[model samples]
Structures are given as structure tokens and as C-alpha cells.
Target chain A: MPKPAPHIDILPDVPLRLNRCHEACGPGADAFAFTLAARLNGPVMWISESWTPAQLNPVGYSQYADPAQLLMARTKDQTDTLAVAEEALRAHAVRLVVTELTQPISLLAGRRLQLAAETGQTTALCLIPQGMGSNAADTRWRCTPVFHQADSTQARWEIIKNKAGTLSAWDVRWDEKTRHMLVVPPAGNRPGLADASG
Target chain B: MRPVDGPFALTLHEANTDRIYCLNDPAEGQGLSQGMGLADARAFCPDLQSRPADPAADARFLRILARWAKRYCPWVGLDGRDGLALDITGAAHLYGGEAALLEDLHARLTRAGLQVRSGLADTKGAAWAIAHYARGVAPPGQTRNHIAKLPVPALRLPEDTVTALQRLGLRTVDDILTLPRATLTRRFGTDLLMRLDQALGDQPEEVSPLPDPPSFAAQMSLPEPIGLAADVMAGTERLLAQVCTRLTQQEAGARALLLTLRRVDQASQQVELRLARPLRDAARILPLFERGVSAVDAGFGIDQLRLEATQVERLPARQLSPLHAAHQDKLHDLITRIGSRIGLDNVHRYLPADSHIPERSYTTAVAAYSDPSGAWVTLRPRPIRLFPPEPIAATGHRPPRHFRWRRMSLSTARITGPERIAPEWWLQDDSWRSGLRDYWQVDTRQGRRLWMYHTPQTPGWYVQGEFA
Candidate 1:
């Protein structure tokens, strides 16, 4: 019998890419990235292009990850931004390396980044625009924001591709009280909706 | 022979007249001296080959020579436009003795294609006189006798004073020393007596050494120039080891280090590394210089490598648990690597500022120099991202039912509050020019949430941030 495939987790020493479904889905992906980084052991290195205007606000970012633990680098172009991310990944001191690119990265470049992350045992997250070409990542995800009730912090995530080729989707919301991401169940399984006035 | 193997002189033109500034040995043998009128000099040797003198180039060469003199002594001062004085008082012992030291210096400089003359004396006046007129060492107690026979010009006095003294039949220092002190003072206006006393060691004179150059540096000069990156890395490692050892002995750490590579072609390239914290471990500091070493273009080859700790700080002692210490080390290493790649100024940490205005509530500070302290005041809800209050096309002082921001039209479905934040009057902030602001959290129909405020001072509404 053939050996079972190795289970893959979004663990340390793995490179994971989270591609947004659309431009409006960036905030949701960023929230997931921060939540993932919060579980790591070291600081997070965030590299962005100089032309990118979105900046991480400490006040809101402090809820998921310590703002002091976020080290940011703004590069002049996508090439430098990716290079900085690779270098940060190679450094074992950083637990996570997050890079945002306006353009798609080549397969070879993605492989190099994956190798660096694996060697250093660092978790790498690449945030790219929707419809970008394929990359050599252990897991590729597409995150989108879900419209919920007023004042609800809900986000939807779809595992577009995985190492085992398994695809799945989940609706999640950031629980402010617990400071954790809670997976929202299907409507039928939810408490109030399952049984009415029983 | 007139054109091929003849006398040559360098002429300088000043005040509409040409003068002989320098001449070859053959011209000197023909009695053509420096400062002689060109017409007269040509009369002496009609076959003279004369070229214009370049004083600027000569001064530049002199300055270069002064820099080279630093190899022998830490304190090398320019004696004049054509001379360098090295204070080798304590440093002479390293070369066996004062006489051997002078001989070595003279031989090395002469081999470098310079006409060298050296003198050792107890005073600056005596040294200047002996170096120019006598060209030998003047023993400490015998400085007076050594300079007695030298001409009055050796005293470094004005040419008019020398001429006036010569007319009085006092050509040598001995003649002036033998004269009555009061008479010498009255006749020469104390200048002659002062020079006499200074040369005899009766009066003290201080030699102002060149302002101390940067310290806390180690350098290695390779015998054979190497062009390989490995060689540069090895050289850097050796230099860093030496410098870090010294830093440890001094109980200090370096915050900034500069590594300089002197190429074989006399070009120097430098790589600067700034650390987020003061560090002295050579093992940790060596890797920070690896990328910089590879980036250097060792055209021809590199002959010397120098590492200088330009900025230093006192590292305070801290007690840490093993786990905590390891984590701190990891953080420091990460910060240092990122700082080296993207400059330390780009890396910053946010500190809570003591203010109520949303924009003024936090300040960005350089991570290397600041520590995050103080509690964050979270009395009111703040947006995850705060931007310059962008004016929204809203209707009135109350929350807008419909508005356009960043080319997106949104209809408000629910509103939370009017949190009033008063401006700090003492601080002059351009953004806070409007006195009072009433902030409201609004959920829009397009699945968007924004923090909009109405300013009573300006009577307008603006959207400042978005909640994620």
C-alpha cells in the first residue's frame, strides 16, 4: 500500500501564501495574517512597497498582535520588497515574514522564498492581488470579507489550494472578549437557529 | 646637450614678474637658486628649461604626506606649508631610541621619493632651527650650542629682521646671544630675545598636535592584496575580533560600526552597520557585515580593512531567565538584521503619547533608541488605521445619512456615538486647528464602517479612519 501523505499545518518553517479574492478582501486577509502571527514565537517582519499607502495602525493591530513586535520595511519596488522578505525569512530570529506585492511573483522566486523559510524554520506569508499566477507555496488561501450583522467583525476564508489538494471554506469572526478567531458554524448548527423556543 | 641633458627650472609668476620657484640639480650647480628673478636666472644659464610652478598641487601633495605620517605617530602636525612635526616623545621607545626612530622615519620618507630632513631637540624653536640649518639631533641640554652657529633666519623671524640683524653684523644666533639682553630687547623689540630664550629651553613652547583622530578602531594591512570575498570576510572578522575585545575590556558596547576597505588602487569603500542595541559579541557582529562585504567591488584588490566603532553606549547589566534571555537575543538579532538592510530610521516603535486627540495619542520613535513603556489609554474606541482627516461630502453637523469618500458612496445604517475629544490648546497641531471634534462610528450600507467626525470650530464633517 502507498504511504499516506504527510499532514501539513500552517506551522513554523513553512511558507504559506494568502491571495485575496479581490481588492476589498485585503483587510480580511490582513486580519488573518495578524492572528496567525500572534501564535508564533518571535517578531513579525512586514515588507511593503513604498507606493503602498496602507499602514498598520497600532491601536487596532494591538488587539491581535503586539504592535511592538511588528517590524516594518518599505521598499522602493516589488523586487526589493520580495528580496527583503526573503532575507528576513532567512534570519531565524523572526518568526514570520509578510510581504505585499502589487504584481505577481515568478515561480522561481517563490520557490527560493519557500526554501529560505524552510531552512530558517520561519513562517512566510505572501499577500498578493487576486487572479495572480500560481506560486510554490505549501498552502495557498483566498480570504474574503463576509457581510454580517451591523457591528460584527466577520470574515470568510477559502482554502483555494493545499498540499493535499483539499479545498475548504470557513466563516470566522474575531471574538473581542477572548481575543481569538472563532469559527462560526453553519446556520443549522447555530444555537438559536437550530431550535426555536424549545 | 643643451636641450636633452641640460638644466631645468620651475618658474612662478607673481606681481607681473617671473621668479624661479625650483630647479634641477644641474641648474642648482650653475648657481640658479630659488626666488631668483627669471631674467637673472636665464642670464646665469641661458639653456634653462623653465615651466610654471603649481603651488596648489604642491600644497595638496603636502597634505597627503601629512596623512601618511599618521602611520608613524598618532600626533602628526603640519609644521609649515612644507614640513610635518611628529611628537614622538613617548612613542620613540617603540623604535629602539630617538635617534633610530628619526633615522627610520627619514629613510622611509626618502625611499618614498621625498627629500627628508629631521631634527630632535628639547624645544620647538631648537628643532626647527636644527632641522633646516644643521640637519642632526640636538641633545636635550646642548640645544643652545647646537643652534648657536645657525643663521638668524633659522629662528623663523621675518626676512626684514634677518636683513636688519645682518646689516648690524649679527648673522648667527651666537652673535645675538652674546649681546646684552636689555639691548637686544630694545633694539629688536623683544622678538629677538624671545627667540633666544625659546631656543635655549629657558622658555616653554607647546607643539599643538593634530586634533586627535577617531579612536576605538582596529585595522589590518594585507601583505598581498586579495580580491576574493572570502578574504574580505576573514579580514573583517579579524578586525572585529580585535575591536570587540577592546570594547569588552572597556566595559562598553558599540551601537554603530563602520567597516572601511582600502583598495589597492587607493580607493576606499565603507559599509556602516547600526545596531538596535549596544552589542560587543564578535560572533553576532560578524554576520551583520557579510552582505556588505559581498557588495563591495574589490576592483584590482583590497589592501587594508579597518573597523571603527563610531558610536558606543554603556550596556546596563540585566538579570534574565534563560527563556527570556534567549527571546531577547532573538529579538535583538532580528532588529539588527532588518535595520542593516532597510536603515534604522525606517524601523520604529509606537509609544503612547499623553493626549486625548486621536492623532496625538501615539508617536513613532526609532526602535533602536526607545523603549515601549507607559500604559495605553483606551478610554474610547479608536480606529485601526488613522489618516489625515479626509473631508467627506456630507450635508450637516449630524451624522450623514449619505456621503461620498474616496469615490465610494455609502449610506449610513446605524450610528454609535458622539465621543467629544477636545483639542489641547497649548500644542499647535495643524490637524487640530478646529477646536472641538465630535466623533461617531457609523456602519454603512455597503458593508463598510467608518469613523467620521464633525468639527464645531470649522463647521464641517470629515472621515478619519476605517474599522476592520
Candidate 2:
């Protein structure tokens, strides 16, 4: 049997997931990592196929300097970069780590991220292949593009995978304009549709 | 055959230039009859290599020589195509005498494989004339008599002017000097008298001493270019320290800083850091530059590092407020920190401008640099958040009860205005041709509310903002 991955203690009473995800996974994984970084107010490791150190910390974040917290990388590689990224994820004070190119991860990483988010704890977003699934996750999500309500703008969000939840999975919408997720009405309230207005 | 003693004229005419101006030739073909054209000159002497003229390269070489000559005198200006005029009044004594300095200049040029003629006089024109005309090296104080004997061409006048003088039977400068000054001025124009006056040092001619352009910048050229971010940070720190020292000496602080990285290939990468307030402290500056340098794309390697402070204001030693020294310092520190992170321009404080127009009354400028409180003015009540005026479709115009904004409808519950805001006739803006605006506060069914106004002059209504 393989030895359990050695874990570094980031915060008390927190479990860190250190695993690598495949590079084929695009920005859906990256968006999750960034969202967690903003929420955690500390460093998170993110491993992806094409990423520059510059893209991680944009000039805009300079306004919110060190006291506000910063994202940092401990170690990186093709297979284990995601694992190290997970190390950044599971802390109360520090929330998430995103790793790329390890054992195929699907619902396991998603569930862990969702669990952390449910408790208002820091979440880790793992970018793995489509088929990788584990029974350990609280929720598993697949991100896909959707049309914006007002204009021809296209936006994408995770396709929710939940083991225990009352919210309908298909009706969830993430508004890019307002940077918020809104529950789309089962029958959307379209005044324009009622009036037949262009 | 005896060689011409003392001095004789040598013109580097195109055809004979190569043969006569040959490097390391003991007898440099001077005085030997080689006529005007290259074919004729080559016929006179075989084995002549005709190199194409490179004027640009020749000019650059001359400038390099000029830089080296700064050791003799600080004030040096290039005279015409092939001449250097040095103001050696006080410097002559340092080189023992004018004769020794002239000898030294000749030897230096000779060692550099260049043939040169040098002269010293009270005036530049006289010295120039003596060097090209009378003697290869003129003695001090003898330029007046030496130049007087030379032809009018040696005065450095145009070819046309020389021809005109020759037409007037005035071939030599002595002939012009002997003519009445009024006659020379009237017949040949003021150019003749001007050149004569310049030679005798009657008129004051100014040499634009290259104004050491306000050295607002300090830089260092590295022995070898460096690519690492750490190296750039180190260079930035050094430059900041130097700049801070300069700022301190001037009792000033920099509000804006420009850090320039000159790469090995002569390409430039610049990072600009703007501060909320002018500060001279090195601690505040170094970290800002540390953040700035990290973003600089060090393509290949950076060979030169330069730091310039563009906007400067006096940084008076903070006079500790007896009431709250700590608070003021802390506020100043916070402004510096926040300004460093975001751009200084992004962080602003509102101050009142002298105008009646609601929008024009207040202006935003970098917070710490500008006064926060504005003067009290009696005018129309201003909205907390003035959004871009969105056009609204309404009926029965005094003030509509409800209007749609961003696809949401809001109904007016209260009307508080007919606030008359007039546009300043002195200042003209097409948009504010709106003579007056009557503002109203409105509420909506969806727990949303907004502030809308009616333009009385144009007779139209606009939704200005929401009560967030």
C-alpha cells in the first residue's frame, strides 16, 4: 500500500488536500482558485497548464498588499503542483490550494471545495479530468458556458454536483457583471418576454 | 625642393583628399600637384584607395574627441563642420601657457591619427581665421594682425558673400576694414560689419552653456547587464537612496517617480510609481520601487538603471501636532502605503471648484496631496453618487412618479426640488447647456430607489443615480 501523503499543518483543525490534476482542464479550474484566493485573504497554490507568475498576482491587487494577504506558491510540478496547491486550500486562516496533473480528480476535489465553502471555511479547487470521481466529496461541479440575460455576452460556471442539497442544480446562474451567483427563477421573470419588447 | 616653411593653406578637396590625407604618410602629399577629380588624382599617383565619405561616422568621431577635450576646458562648442572652439582664458594658465596648450592639443590629435591646426586669440573668429589662413598655429595676442592679412573667405563667410566682396574689389579683410564702416554696412549689408565686429570682439555673442538640465534623475550604468528581479530591486534601492539624498538636500519630496531600465540592446522598460503625497523618505520609496521593478520585463538584460522624480513638493519636517502627533503620522503613513499599492491617481479626495454647475463644483485629486474639506457654498443640493445621466421615457413632464433605469422601474414617492443650477456663461460645455435641473427622489416596488432630475431648459428628464 502507498504511504499517505505527508501534510504540513497550516491551521488548527483543518485537513489539506494535496493532489495534482491534468493540464487539459482550462480556466474553470483557475476561476475557482482565484475565487478562493479572494475569500481566504492569504496565499493559495494553483497549478495549471499555461500560467505565468504575473497572472497570479495582477497589478490591481497591489492596492490590497501584505496585510490583506497574498497568494504564494510552495512547490510546483506537472503531477504534484496541484497537491502543493491543495496544501494552500484547507486552512481556516488560509483557505485553498489548486493543484494540476496528479491522479485524476473529479467530485473529490469539488466536494472538498464545496465543504469548505459550506462551513464558510477556506476552499480548495482542484483541476482534474472529467472521469476522476471519489466518494469523499460533499459536492462535485462541472463548469460550462451560458448566455448572459441582457446582452450577447457568454459566461460560465460550475455544473453543481451535490450529495445532499435542496437547491436545483440546473437553475444556478453566476452573474459576471455583478460578480455574484443568483438563483434563476424556474420560470425566469422576464418582463421583456411578457411585453414582447425588443 | 625646399618644403614650405611655417604654414601654407591645405584644402582637402574631394579628389586629392585620399592621397594627401593618407595615414602614417611622412610627406602627406600636401603641396604635391594632385588636381580636383579622383581619376585625374589617381593618374597623378597610383595605388590610391578611394574610400566613400562617411559624414555621420566622421561627426560621431568628432563628438568623441570633443568629450575628451573637456579636460582642457568645460565650455566647448563645435564650430562649423571641422572646427572646435574652446574658451581657454583661465585654463591657459593651468596648461602653463596658450603656446603649451596649443602644442598639447596638436600632439593629442596627432597621437589619435588626426591632423589639426590650432590657434589662440581674444576672439573665436580671429583664432579660426589664423588657424585656417595665416599660420598652422597662431601665437597668442597676434590674431588681429594675422587675420587682417587673410582673404575675406577666411572670415568663415558664405561663398556668395566672398564672391560679392571680390566683385566689390575687396578680396582681403584688410580691404574691407580700410573701407568706411557706413559704406560697408549700406552696400554689402550688415553681414560685413557683423563679421568685422565679431573678429574685433565688439559685439557680445553668447555661448549657450549646455544647461545641466535639472538633474532630477540619478542613474548607474552596471559593468554587466542583469536579468534577475533581485538584481533590479538592488539597483532600484541604490538609485532610490541617491535620489532621496538629493530630495533631502533640496528639502523636497517626490509625488511621482519614474524608474527606467536601459537594456543591453538599447531598449527601454519603464515603470512609473505615483505617490498620494510628496515624500522624501527612502523607506516609502524603496518598497514602491520594489513592487514596480517586479513588473519590469527585463528582456535580455538591463545595463543601466535610472530613477527620476518628476513632481516634487517641499517636504517640511513634520511639525508634530501637540494634540495628535501619532495620528497625523499614521494617517500620512497609511496614505503612502495605500497609494503605493493602488495607483495614486485612483485614490482621490473631493475639493470644491469655483463654479455653480453641480458637477463642476467639485474635482477629485490625489487625496493626501490635496486639501480634503471644501469651502461652503450655497447652491443646489448635490447627489451623493452622480452617475452618468441616463435618458428616461416619461409622461406629463413636471416630474414623473416612476421611471425605468438599467431595465428596472422606480416610482417617485417624494419630490424635494426644482433646484436651479445655472451653467456659467464664461465656461461653455455642450452637455450642460441644460439651463436648470429640478431633482426628485423616487422609490420603487422592488425595494429599490433612485434620484432623478428634469432639465428645465431642454425640457427633458434623466435618471442620475440610486440611493445605495
Candidate 3:
């Protein structure tokens, strides 16, 4: 088995699927994405659809990753978006290739992307909306915004599925001073809810 | 040459008419004038040989000759179909003098089996007149003296104007020049006066030379016509190599290249390639022409191939680390391939803008031209993506507990307080007319995260963006 990379502690050396629990959890996923991309060695390629209203703002993203090392492609459709991501992975230049799809991808497409990532020794992340169909991804993570305190940057991430069959969760807070995500322990030893029951 | 030779005086038949468009010097010597009826010409020179006139071939040959004349002077103009005008202003001293330049030009062309006549004068009009009417170089400042003896037709006036002047017994330029300027203008109109003044150097006439077509172009004429794709590719590779060499020497790269194939059947085909980034490497540029080259019909067979860089740009010096440089090159190559497949307009990159407003904080620019710069001010949380503010049906002055958005009735699970973002009053934005906004991060029961803001002035709540 391939060991997980030092900085990328969430999954092994394989492509990961990030499923957004809500429409508003996009920022949290992007925050984790940039953190993961920053640890990689080479440049990054971000592919998205042209109709996507919210794009990766370089100004905001640059805070986490080197903006100069980032390349973007706005594809016309979902197929082109996935193709671009796959091509970027196979190019062996980008350390990470991120793509967002309006609809869920097929198992074949997911396997193809995974194969390309393994061949190029690169990481791939597919950002999809909630309740999408399953694919052959190594790990599936669902990120949701945790609204505990006002003006707090906290997110709850649940590893719903993993290739190793291990399930875990974390209440992650973005530490502005350290510029790294800190895993917050459960409060008062109370049993932590698997889902946001607010 | 065959058309001009034979046992008869040769004349060319006009394409659309039965009249004689032009006649060889031998036929002209036999009293066969141009624009004469074919029957009349046949009668005048009982053994008159006639062939159809090809104006396209004539124009093409003239253009080629004009290009060849560039060896003498940078500025060469095609004077009519059979004549060439060269502005050898400062280039006269290179070949001894003005007289020697004309002699060399005439002698070289005559040796090339061409009946060449050249004239040198201060003005283009006088030079043209001397070239056709008199076959020698005219002394500088003696244009008036030299052209005075030439006929009125030598002034390049309209045929009707020349005939009208001839009717008035003004058969020569001297006759018109001797006449009073007012009478000449009144009788023959301002055209006659303008032509007379232009020839006599009284009025400045700008001889606008034809635009030198392509700055970087290489051409090869094969001994035999090549119909095979491999032969055409070989020819193209040679041209590309030559052009790329020149580009490298000049420290420039071509942004667009044009390949013209002249077939033996007189039909020409062109293939054009537009590049995303300027490039000079022939090895890299050759494969790009495969699609374009194969698309060329190559009707009959191509006898001539010309490669030209229609658009060029100065290549910036690369100053990156070795590792990063290789990655950058690969990225650039990938972008170029994708851009060539789709289009450069489809590739975009975001650049930070100097604005505090959420929507105005960034701008989109073509990826080829922009590089990421500056730091993102993340003093407060900003959504990964922002949309046009959609009004939400909510009933509350404070943050609403439940709202209807996108046809979904959802209850707010938790609400973060209104982060008041005041409008920038200095700038007039139509969307911000509501003055002040109090934003809240709303988490709904349906696991949907939304960034909604309450416009105090407009007294309404709207969904501005969504968290990832």
C-alpha cells in the first residue's frame, strides 16, 4: 500500500472526492483544497465550468497557495472540465488538479481520473454537490459549515467513506495565526453527533 | 515569349470582349494598336496571332517583380501593370550614382531576357513619363525641361482628358504648361491643372508605395510541381526552419503564421495558424501545421510555397529557476495546445483588484497575459463563489429564522450575526443603491450554507453567495 503524503494526512496517495453537504460549504472545501495543494511540490491546475458563478478568487486563494504557481481553465461544459482535469493530471507538471462538476461523475470517469492520477503521481480532487451518486473514489469526504460562534471560522468534516474502511470526523477551525487547520477536540467529552443536528 | 513570336504579329484578346486588349511590340510595329477591334487588327496585320489575356497572371508577375525590385530600394511601387516605380532617394549613392543605378537596373533586366526601360527623376510623375516616353535618366531639378517635350498622355491624365487636350491643339506637356493656369483649369477642369502641377513639381505628390506585405516571409519555388503531401510537408518544414532562424536572430517569435501554396493550375490555397503564445521553434511549430497543410487541396500540383509570419512579438527573457522553468514551459505548451484546439479567449485567470466590494474585488483576464500578483486580504470571511444577489422571501427585521429561496422553504438551523458592510459612497453602483448591508452566514436545516445580507435602505433580505 502506498503511504499517505506527510502534509496530506486525510487520505493515502490517491484521488479523493470532496462532497459538499450544502451549497454554502464551498468555501470550507476550497479552504481545505488550498491547504492540500500548498503541500504539493509542483504547480496546480484548477478546472471549472464556464457557467459557474463563483470561481476561485486568486486574491483569496493566494493567501493559502502561491498564486503564481496556479493555472486555471474555464471549460465550456462538464465533460470538457473533467477532460481538462484528466489531461492536467497526465501532464506530470501539476502536483494537484482540482475540478468542480455541476453533476455527479460516472464510475468509469472516476476510475479514469484515478488511473491518470496514479500514473502521473499527482493528486486529484473532484468537488461535487451533496447527495450525488457514488463513484470509485479512494475516499469520500463531506464538509459542512459549523455555526457555533459568531465570526468563527469553523467547519465539520466527516469521512463518510474510505478505501481503508476507517470512518472518522473532525471539528476543524482555520487558525488565522498559524495559517493551518486545527482539529478541535469534542467539548466536555459529550458524544459528538455524526451529523449536524442543529 | 511564344505568344509574342511565331509568323504573325501577336495580340491578346480581352476576356469579356472581342477587342484586342494589348499587342506585342512587333504587332504594334505592324500598326496593331491596343483596344482596336480584332477584325481590324487582323486586317492590319493579316497574320495576327491572338491569345486570351490573363490579367491575374499579369498582376501576379508584376507583384513578384515589385518584390524583386526591393533589392534596389526598400520602397518599390507597382506603376500600372508593365512599369515599376522605385524611390531610390538615399540609395542612389550605393551604386555609384543615379545614372549608374538606372543603367545597372536596365542592363540587368535586359540581360534577364526582358525588354526593360527605366527612368530616374525627382518626381514619380516625371520619372514615369520619362520611362515610357523617353528611355533615359533625367537630371535632378530638370523634370520640367525633360517632360516638356513629352506628349500630354505622358502626364498620366485620363484618356478622355488627353483627347480633349489634343482637340484643343494641346498635344504636348509644354503646350499645356505654356497655357495660362486659369484657362487650362476652366477649359480642362482641375484635373489637368493638378496633373500639370504635379509633373512640374509645383504641387507635392506623395507616391504612396505599396505596403510591404509580410515582414518575415520565406518562399521556395520547386523545379517540378509537387502533389504529394510528404513533399509539401518537406517544403513547409524548410520554410519554417528558415523563418524560425530569422525570428531567432531577431529575438522575436511569431504569433500567427500564413502558408500560401501556389498550384500549377493557377489556383492558390492558404493555411493559417494562430498561436496562443509567441513561438519560434520549428520543431514545435511544424506539427501545428499538419492539420492546416493536409487541408490544402493541392489542386493539380503546387509549384511554389511561401511561409510568412503575419504577426510577431518580442519574446521575453526567461528568468525562472530550472525546476520551475521546466514546469512553466510544460504548462505553456499545454495551454497552447488547448488554446489551439478551442480558443485563447476561453482560457482565463483571475487577478486581484483594488476594491473592497465583494463583486468588485477581482477581474478576469486572459491567462496568457496575466500573472497572479498581490495578497488576498482575508480580514473577514468571503465565500468561494459569489452570485448576483437573489432576493429572498423573508419576514423579519432581525436575521430571519426561515426563508424561501430558489423555490425551497428552509428553516435556518443557525445564524451568524449581521456583519455590517457599508456601501462605498464615492462610487455609484446600481446594485449598491440600497446604501448599507448587514450580512449573515446562514446554515439551513437542509444542509445548505448561504451568505445572505439585509439591505437596510431597501428593507429587504437577499442571498449574495454560498460557502463551498
- Top-TM-score structure, candidate number: 1
Q: What tens-digit string does per-residue lDDT give for candidate 2 at A1-198? A: 987643322112222333322121322443334333443454333334333221232222222222123323323244334333433333233334454444565555545544543343444555556646454554445543333333211224333444333323333333434433344443347545555444
Off by over 4 Å in 1: A1-25, A193-198, B1-214, B316-321
**If chain B of candidate 3 is superposed on the true chain B, what is its TM-score?**
0.53
Residue clash pairs of candidate 1: none
Which lDDT tens digits does candidate 1 get at residues B280-330?
A: 999988988887888999999999999999998876546667766766776
Off by over 4 Å in 2: A1-140, A144-168, A171-198, B1-54, B136-140, B211-285, B288-468
Model 3: per-residue lDDT, tens digit, B183-228?
Answer: 8778778988887777778888775677754358999999999988
Q: Candidate 3: where is the Cα deviation over 4 Å?
A: A1-7, A11-28, A59-63, A66-68, A131-134, A187-198, B1-214, B217-238, B258-274, B286-308, B316-323, B407-429, B443-449
Q: Which ten residues in a row have the lowest lDDT in candidate 2 chain B?
A: B19-28
| Candidate 3 CAPRI-style tier | acceptable
Docking class of 1: acceptable
Best by lDDT: 1
Task: Give candidate 1's whole-model lDDT.
Answer: 0.77
Task: Report the CA-based lDDT of candidate 3 relative to the real structure.
Answer: 0.75
Clashes of 3: 8
